[model samples]
Target chain A: MGRKQVWEQGEVLASAMRLFRRRGYLGASLRDLEEATGMHPGSLYRAFSSKEGLFSAALDDYNERVVEGRVRAHLRDAEDPVAGIRSFFTSAFDTGGGPEPDPGCLLTNTAVESFSVPHVAPGVRRGLETIESGFADALTRAQAQRLLPEELDVEKSAAQLLALYQGLLVLVRSGTDAAKLHTITDGALALIRARNATAKQADEEEQR
Target chain B: MGRKQVWEQGEVLASAMRLFRRRGYLGASLRDLEEATGMHPGSLYRAFSSKEGLFSAALDDYNERVVEGRVRAHLRDAEDPVAGIRSFFTSAFDTGGGPEPDPGCLLTNTAVESFSVPHVAPGVRRGLETIESGFADALTRAQAQRLLPEELDVEKSAAQLLALYQGLLVLVRSGTDAAKLHTITDGALALIRARNATAKQADEEEQR
Candidate 1:
């Protein structure tokens, strides 16, 4: 493809991503897609094949740009991995006091909206697993640095955090109060820290 | 209305609930509703007013029957409130080894699928709050009975549990392994228990 064609495709996917994120998979009609993407039906079909194809491509774009981007910023690169995970959760509900309520994570919305949609299921699973594994890696590092307890089950805690992450998104989408969500997030992190302290104390008692 | 009319309304709502649970608010078309409820479009609109009206009614019916029924069975009536809450989470993924995957909680799905939907938002909020308050009530009882630590923050813990519950349903809907979900649930419950134990031990140490 020429440079202009590549730029146009990129623009189209970005527009499609916004529409899908806002409206969800089933909610975004073809006409809505056309309006969002500024493409005629014939051109859309010629370019992306079908609505499902377009949606699938959009999901991929979301995973790469949004999902992986957060992982890189908050988990992989942040100085404090555990705090990074908390920051990741914070970002979900930090709508910047915008008039529009948070649209929520695209991967999470897709997971809830298109669980049985075959074309989109793989991308949904992949995106979700990315976050789960990111948590696991971060918790593992935290434990290694003695930030978390040695007895902490990194894998299980990671999975639990993943659930908490998804749950917060669901609540945010439902227009839950940000303050309440922040309390819940704090409670979860405190549980982890409290558990670590308890474990460390227990180890000290055993040594005595 | 006649007795037959009342019975038919119940039946139609039941069918509509199942379809909405399966397809979500936006995914369920009028044709799907017709096929699910065995009603023509004219009859459906006449009875429920509009597609949104039918969905709203279906959500109300779900809240009354499924949400409240579970609270009655697992939280209100169960002998052990914390265990009851556990059972409630268990029921979300318990498909009895059926060929079909679990459809997930209707309120959680709606919260994800139709957050901005004006007509359906209230029902979604009511249904979700019902579960959150159920957890709160159950936790309060558990703390009163000394099954939990006195220092436990009932409200925060309840909100966290609510998030975990919704998160588990989202994962289940996305076809996460049942065993993994069970592990996550177990981890969450164990954290509560462990925290309680730690708090109790600290109190004992203080007395010494």
Candidate 2:
């Protein structure tokens, strides 16, 4: 055998992530992976073992780079926890005015595509949990600050927010225009605010 | 060539829809389609042209039967429009208490799987539009009857409801328990009711 060639794992993973997102897990072919990563079939196997192995690594990369990084930045940099939640919804549409070639979340995509490949389903589940927990933490903070309805079930609300977020991503991927998505996200924020407003009204009524 | 065999298009579409729902568009194979529909490869080709062709037919069937049928029934059978909207959401989780082998919406599945296959994306869009319009009609009626907030933008609220409903479906498909899905759905309905309650409090305050 010739001298074993070494490759940058991150570079391979980045390319794999893009390929998997664009073509999906089952739709992506070995030739597509080879071309995207500039690795021959033998090198691809030597480095990643199998397509599924490569997919798992790519999913990890997506979780860290896309989901985790975005969640932390949005939550940390916001004016407050409520604003942070609103910011989270708005930022999904800030993809710069360029035409979006691929617009869906890879984790959401994997959730739909994970039926056949059961091993990857757990990764999607974890990605979903990360999002749910992020929303849960924010909602909890909002409640403590009296910015959210005291009666809000943080766990259930967080799960609902996660689902709405995932659904918005699905609509975005399904070719809904940015303007319409912005309206939907705005409506969501209004609903959240209305919950708090209604609680305040109830308090005022009791005092009266 | 032997005489073309007559095949029931409805049966083929139903079988293809099930296979596509269980295994995603990309994950479902020609062999799986053949096995599900009980048709040989040549007959399958003769009937539907190609895999994409069959997927298109299956998508049409899903739109007609699952999506439109459910929306119409929920809206018509309810006591009123607002009740119709609530009914629309409540009906999604009524799976008769059996083990839910498939817990997600087929159109939502197609939406995620529509990235590479641009042709099928329109069908997902139509499904979403039908849902949004259904919610909008109900909300409009609710506003006229003073059951919803006057300032509510029916269009945006409808889209938001669509996203929430779609999100709920995604959660269901992701192995969330049926009871949990029910709670999440209940939370959504409460949010909708709270919108009007807050408005009622504001009116009472004005009167006071």
Candidate 3:
């Protein structure tokens, strides 16, 4: 790829990500890509090879640019690993509140869309794995610091957190008025906080 | 629609539901629909109006036949309401273990797919509402029967359960053998079980 070609590829991938996120992998057509990227069908095919190829690139872009970046920030920035887990959620799913056009998570959307499009499913699954491991790593760090209860299952908690995160995205897609997600997030946080309390109680017991 | 046409419509909707669940709304094309339902494009269009029309009907069929039926069974059959909630998860997601094709939930798939297809989003949202409210109602009943913690936030717990349910579906779709989903379910059940223990303690305190 030449400099201009590489730059154009980046632009096309970025645009395709937005399009796929808004309109699912199968929903968006080649014409739609042409319109979004200002490239004719012939050029788009030559560049990305196929619609599946373009969608795969877009999903990779999503993983690298959006999901991985967030994971890096949340995992690296926070001194407290558990707090980093909490922040990962509040930021990924902040939604900014109220009824809005919440598309939920792009990777999650692809995960669901993957069932239909086998060619692109692997990329979507990899994206989910990246997130699951990222969360599990932070949780392991929390365990190392004894921030979580000794008996607390880090892997399980990580999965619980993953479910809560994706589930909330599913709920938010509806644009409901009730504070449904608020309670869900608080409940999850409470579970983590409860572990913290248990750890503290254990520490006090040991001190005595 | 004639009696024969109505029967055919039911069969087509049933087949379409499976296709949509597997292929998603946009991923499966008209030809795919015909292949699934054994109907020609002209017949399919005449019967269902359009591809979107067939998809909408399939979603409704899924809502009525699959989701609502499970909600009814779990809510009505189990006397212990919390256990009913537990059984609901186990039955709805019993993939029968090992490497199998677990499509997760059709409603959840549509919920993810709903971000793009405007016509089908409402039905998907309604299906979620049905589950959330069903869980909430069961919790409410559990509280009235003193089966759960009196102070337990039924709505919040319901929302948390919602997140857990959808999130597990997302995880299972990836075919990861991390035992991630197991912990999520156990952790969620523990939260409810903790409430039960709390209720028992409260009862003891009252007697004392």
Candidate 4:
């Protein structure tokens, strides 16, 4: 209602997201939300239609502020697809490498918590699928330009990249050394690179 | 606590594990715990101590029964380390894969929750780390036996495996297709195998 109330509402949602990311939808509560956001039940309810509503806002914030802006940008920023993927992963590891790491990605977190309740599961589902599609589309374009392997299944390859990102984030959050993550990603990206190069050789030979 | 109450404790904890695994700690409530486990707060507390106490027990149950007993057994039952890792991944996917999936690993879910709250954080940390260590150790030994490969860092390699498992389970819970999960796992595992073989071959040739 008041200006402070609006700011508090945003603050409440942020706290809720952090708590939700830390615990999950079923694990968090109105009380926890209140404590974190500094809002009482009536105020919390007035701002958020329900607990689920708060969670939905938190997830939206996570995707918009972090996943699209950070993760995807990290992937696409390199001069090429291969370099882009590598940069994305390096950032993924280093970003979480500090003493404090936000558990890899909140999007990955959403994939886990959206199932047991009728809350914002769809939003999370779409978020996961949407990112995978973006990467897949990139890979497809790369393949057409001979940047990726012809053998790469557009959707499956996308999922593999998505899986790698998701899995690597978990490791980072779990406090793995950056060197180890580098090795893991190096090995993975190498495989993708090899596949791409091999496909190119075959295509060149066929054209000749 | 009465004998009947003590007897019900295990069931209550079991219910908690299933619910916690499915919904995570913050998402599920005392009322949800009561409804799921069919116990009153007084009785539940009398048996387990508190909500955090109950969670601690549930995590233990997950280790002893779900992970150690079931997952480990399946891994060992496989013909080789490659298959063993596959078994572990498949099991993670099995629980997570379906038309509707449960998105959380009980241990990963605990880690997410415990990070924000210091209350039961220690136990949560210990349990999840134990599982990660278990998978890595098993994979390392498999590599030592030449079932995995020489280039793979046992710790790093194992983290990769665990990361993929956690990632896929999260996606599955987020409404990822069961079939696509199969693709992600297959692609990931193949690269792991390829890395191992290529590194081993190079090392073997160097020995010659």
After superposing all C-alphas onto the true structure, candidate 4 shows an RMSD in angstroms of 6.6
- The DockQ of each candidate is 0.38, 0.39, 0.37, 0.28
Q: lDDT tens string, model 2, B144-203?
A: 789777776566677778887887777767777776665555545545555532334334
Ranking by lDDT: 1, 2, 3, 4
Over A106-191, each residue of candidate 3 has an lDDT whose tens digit, in order, gives 77777777666678767777777677778778877877898765676555566667777887777666564435555565655555
Provide TM-scores for the models. Answer: 0.89, 0.87, 0.82, 0.75
Put the candidates in DockQ order, highest first: 2, 1, 3, 4
> Least lDDT summed over 10 consecutive residues: which range in candidate 3 chain B?
B196-205
Worst 10 residues of 2 chain A by lDDT: A199-208
**How many clashes (backbone atoms < 3 Å, residues ≥3 apart in a chain or on different chains) does model 2 have?**
0
Whole-structure CA lDDT of model 1? 0.77
How well does candidate 3 match the true structure in TM-score terms? 0.82
Per-residue CA lDDT of candidate 1, range B26-83, in tens?
7788998899888888778878888888888888999999999998888777778878
Maximum-lDDT candidate: 1
Off by over 4 Å in 3: A1-8, A95-100, A143-147, A193-208, B1-9, B40-43, B97-100, B144-146, B193-208
Where does candidate 1 chain A have its weakest 10-residue lDDT segment?
A: A199-208
**Model 2 interface RMSD, one decimal:** 6.5
Candidate 3 or 4, higher DockQ? Answer: 3
Question: Candidate 4's C-alpha lDDT?
Answer: 0.64
Task: By TM-score, rank the candidates, best first.
Answer: 1, 2, 3, 4
Worst 10 residues of 3 chain A by lDDT: A199-208
Query: What is the Cα-based lDDT of residue A117 in candidate 3?
Result: 66
The alpha-carbon lDDT assigned to residue B111 of candidate 1 equals 86
